[model samples]
Target: MKTYQVGGSVRDELLGVEPHDKDWVVVGSSPEEMIEAGFRPIGKDFPVFLHPDTKEEYALARTERKSGKGYHGFKFYYDPSVTLEDDLLRRDLTINAIAKDSQGKLIDPFNGQDDLLNKKLRNVSNAFCEDPLRAIRLGRFLSYKHISDFSITPQLKAIVKKILDSGELNYLSSDRVFAEIDKAMQNHFPEKFFNFVVENKLDKPWLKDINSLDGFSASNSDLRWVELSCLNHFTDFDQIPLPSKIKKLISIAKQLANIEIDNILIENIDSLRILRNEEDIMRILSLGLECMDQNLITKIVLLYKDIKFAELEKLDPNERKNEKINLLKDLVSKL
Candidate 1:
């Protein structure tokens, strides 16, 4: 049996980036043979094994045929007769289809190396449109880099648009959608992912809220969720699985957005501090102050600072809290 380092391991090497994990595509191999050779089978759907020593995944060369609508609706075929070339043919992108042999020789059956050199993202075959998840994957890939010249190939772009138009993306599970977006957010240019969704009219069922928050700077991914929640009036915040910090920020931002300048009482400010802490209160107000006036942020910050050091410290703990609230009420009344 011959084994080849395949997929992202080879793709990242060509891009001059170090791959964190390596996956192997084994040709002329069977499940029983792999287990006999000390490989532990791990995959439930297909013949995949882990090396006894390295513990890296080594999947038998296989091909998949579309069985139904979504990403999981695939029938996989695996055998000793499946060629490495046949396995590579099923990959989504040409860049990902290329493989490297044990001898460190590059295998380029679909001109993947040429496309990689040209910094182009091209589909391997017409089967690229078979899986709706590829549209999401391609979008995430586009956001993976911060390159100024990064773009999708015209044909691939058309295919992705077609896939979205067919409504196949709606079949994708919410967890999978969130997983792809979470990975994209980790990229250096995550805004590209959101832009792709908007440009292609891709956000229908899940990302409707985010799509509405157009032109909002997403340079800080931590703030993106807050921006999404604050920009749109979410009736059910519990519907989306969000971290405690983000959920709190959203709730605070939403409340602060509608808060009247005249009704900013000392009790309300003190309650915010007691529940969410002072730093988070500032962040919530900061979101409201975004794109409006830099001076408002400055003034609010100065007020918070002045309230901290005012004569309220002389009072007892409970009275001090009340005094601080009164101080904020007095200052907020002016604004």
Candidate 2:
């Protein structure tokens, strides 16, 4: 059986970034042979195995046919006759279509290396239109890498527009869409991500009202905070308990909004606070305390107290419940 390095590993190597995970495409290998070789079968639709030692993925060279609609509606053919070149031809992007042999030799059957060197992202074949998810993935690649130099080719954009016009995106699950968005947010370029969605026309139907917001293009961090806050409104954060970092981030954002913080401080506070909230802080502390620290947390608390006091003053005597106003006055006096 011939084992060849393929997919992101080869692409990242060319771009000088150490690949986070290595995937291989194996030719002349069947499921039974892989099982005999101590690899575990993990794919249901296609024959994929996990290496016994390295624990990396090794997928057999295969071809596919569109059997139905949506992304998962495909029939995979895994005959030994299929070659590595045939498998690469089925990929979405030219950069991801390149592969490497067992001896670390580069393989460029589709000029994927040229696209990588030029920092361009082009589709491998017309089969790209068969799958609707490619558009989302393309937008994600743009966002994740923060690569503004490259634009999606007209042919690809036409295909994406066709998919969007078909209204099949409604058939796609929100969990899948949000999962990709969440993964893309892990990168440092969320603003670019939103811009990609808008440019591709995906934001109009799936993500309405979001495009109407002002200052959405301020920075990646600002865009991320706003997006996370909006998403939190839909989800039950109390049940899931967002991490301390995310919680601190949300709290810091709220503080910014309440106090109308300067643009300079907002831009330079710290990267760690972006895309985080108060629940993130509580998780890190792990114990109930009056306050966390005197740095930013203290400032946040004092600002929050001041806001609460102002609101208390706005309440008329008739609206006050018993001695609640008196109690608030006493608390403010102590502060």
How many backbone clashes does every candidate have?
Answer: 1, 15
Which stretches of candidate 1 lie above 4 Å from their native place? 36-38, 146-148, 209-220, 228-240, 243-245, 265-276, 279-335
- Note the Cα lDDT for every prediction shown: 0.75, 0.65
Residue-wise lDDT of candidate 1 within 1-335, one digit each (tens)? 99999998898888888888999999998899999999999998888899999999999999999999888889999998999999999999888999999899999899988887788889999899999888887878877663325567899989988898889988887778877877776677666777787778776676763543244444565566666555555444443355677777666655555444445545544444433355765655555544234354346556666655447668899998667666676778667
* RMSD of every prediction: 4.4, 9.0
Per-model TM-score, in order, reads 0.79, 0.71
Q: Which 10 successive residues of model 2 have the least lDDT summed? A: 285-294
Steric clash pairs (candidate 1): 266-325
The true-structure Cα RMSD of candidate 2 reads 9.0
Error of 1 at 290 (Å): 0.7
